[model samples]
Target: AKWREPKLDGRITEDLTINELEQYWNPLLFIDNILSETKETQWLMAQRNETGEVYLLERRRIKGVFLETLELNDFPLDVQDLTITVTSERPESEVDIIPDQNEMSAINVQTFVDQQEWKLHEHVEITKRIMKQEYSSSMKSHACLSVTCRAARRPGYFYWNVFLIMFMISSLSFATFAVSPDKAELRLRLSFTLILTSVTFKYVITQSLPKISYLTYMDKYVLMSLAILCIISVWHAIVTLLDPEHIATKYSKPANLFDLYGLQQHKSFLPPDTAVKSTNNTQNETDNFFKEHASLDNGFADNLLAFFLGSEQMEEADQSAESKTSTDNGNLSTSVGDQQNTTVPRLSNECSLDNKMACEEWKRVQIVEQHVFTSFVIIYVIAHAVFIFWLYFDASRRRREMRQKDKDYRDFLRRHQQWQQQSLRQRDMHAILRSSLHT
Candidate 1:
């Protein structure tokens, strides 16, 4: 509100109470989007310049919560705008709310309570627009002014507690490969455990966010980790089903010829009483042969067999062989030679076949597991890199937009100042012409 007070020059009145100010003009201002008004204080002041023109300025300080819609596609990495919109009860034709060109809106960042979770920007944006009345059938619009402040969520907390934990859990699936391929039960158990852990972690993370229909970036990452764990579990089952030793046992028939030769060879090297005892245990030994060899750990079985057959027996057998008559020794030698000639070649051929099959199986399992691990690593790296780049570009775009807005605002202020100066000059010219005519 403006008025002319010829009696006053470069003077200002004290702050007027609400009642006193209501005696004059009022715009009937109120917050449009406020949820609740906590406290409000308003006062008016009158100031007169050297030209005897008085200006009435109304100042209001309000504290309250305002409603804002959030976009959570980026979630923990997103920036949000908090706005306070003010609108007048009077229509736009009667009351127009405009920003003060001389005073730019601002926010005090030091007063923000969520400093650890959000970085509040100091600059405030003021937008003035006409809002159409929804209830009115006529084309009625209200003057609305919105003051907005931006705040960026700090992602470090989520990165450490959620993303890092999920990555570690998914990585545990790769460690399951260290278990032998034949132990599919153990590998699968570990993989499933990782999957469950990931799911539970995701649930905990979701509880901290709003219930939205679409997935957030963090949700996508967790899902990818779970998928990788499931793939690992399936691979474990595949490798176990294709186990070489199990296949060989299933297809190969028992060769009693090798067992008979093995028993005779042990008896031939033992002393008389020891040979009798060995003969007695021969049936039991032959029964356990298939079971032991089926689960053999490559060459470790040979060392285990020698360790079980005591060294004392070997020394006694050596003494008995030295004492034996030449005729008996020659007959024993011929018998052993006959057994070797008949059975050794066949046994060697069968053993070689089993070894070749085992070697091929090992190579196939290694190739597949290596490929899976490498592929998962590559995909994980690429996914994180893409997310990082997206965040960087998004922040850059917002910064550019803010800079452009500031530039435009400055230009508007310059033009407004020029127009005001021109109007004042025209008024002075009119006043001079009037004085000249009166003279």
Candidate 2:
């Protein structure tokens, strides 16, 4: 409840006791939106201004929890309004509520202890409104005043801990490509691991925020990263299923280029006496051909080809091939030797064809992977940029609306003051006319 007293003489401002304040009329005012009250204290003070106008002030200090609605679409970058509403029990005809023109509402930010998480603004907003209550078809209007303060959530914590971590984990999914595409199990395992990590991190982040149905900015980012991870895993599966080398390794053992070339070029390293011994061991050689090529799997085949084809190793391999060819000509005596020579060339040609096809397929998949990664990066950047621009423009629009409201309120106060002065002058003139008529 609020009460005030007026006196004719100027006096020093002093606090009045509650018993003394009961002698004056009081407006029954209460906070309408408070959830719970911890403590409240109130006092009255009287003072006179320079113009000899006496005024009474009711000072109140209240500490309690209040109810408020928060919109979290922007989430980590969102601003919230904290409001306190005071409503009078008496109708508008018996009580009036208005902002004090001589005093401006303000907030003391120096005392705020949660500065690390939220930034509190010093400017306070006061609004006067009339609310109508209906009781059995009868209506009464009550005066209400609301004071609001704005606070913006600090995004730095979420940026580093949540968003940055999510981005890094999502990017690691791309590194799965470093593993051979034929090793689909390894690549898929890595991709799924990153995806699960992102999902768990999202849950941890969500625990810090209120449960809401709509997606926030941070939620959108996490979902985007998750989608990218899913795409990466799917691509890995697709490439593995479509790859010729992977299929060959899965169904039947294929002769790899490494075993075929290595055996042909190093055959000359055997001693002259072992040459006939080696030729006689044709059956053992046939068994070793399947064993050696079967172990020469497709993992890192392209990388090995790239290293050997572009380095001094290729020159050494060519020299070894020439020496083996000369040694073969010198030992072309037995019919079994001629048949072995023909079989080596035929096996070499088949291995070369299979290797070339697999390499081309891998190269095509690599190009597609590069394009996909670049597209995802571009899309992510553009989406975030658009979101930021929308937030910026939305904030600017809200500020403009607030300024317009303040301007309109000022105009209303000015007009109300002029109307009061006009009424006073007319009343005085009517009294003077009545006095003259009585005379």
Best of the candidates, lDDT: 2
On a 0 to 100 scale, what is the lDDT of residue 266 in model 1? 35
**What digit string (tens of lDDT, one per residue) describes model 1 on residues 128-202?**
888987977776889899888787778889889988898888877889878866577898888888888888888
lDDT (C-alpha) at residue 268 in model 1: 26
C-alpha positional error of residue 279 in candidate 2 after TM-score superposition, expressed in Å: 21
Cα lDDT over the full model 1: 0.63
Error of 1 at 190 (Å): 0.4
| Runs of candidate 2 exceeding 4 Å displacement | 1-18, 50-53, 133-139, 246-287, 290-363, 380-439
CA shift of 76, model 1, Å: 1.0
- Point out the worst 10-residue segment of candidate 2 by lDDT: 267-276
Per-residue CA lDDT of candidate 2, range 1-439, in tens?
3233564245444555556655666687788889999999987656566556656666789999999999787777777888999988888998898887655565677999899998776556888898876652557889999999877777788889887888789778878878865577899999888988888888888888889899987898789889888988998888766554453333221223434446554232221122223433533564454444433432323223322232333454345344444444223223223434544444333333333444455556667767876876777678667756866676445444545655665676677678878977998899899899999
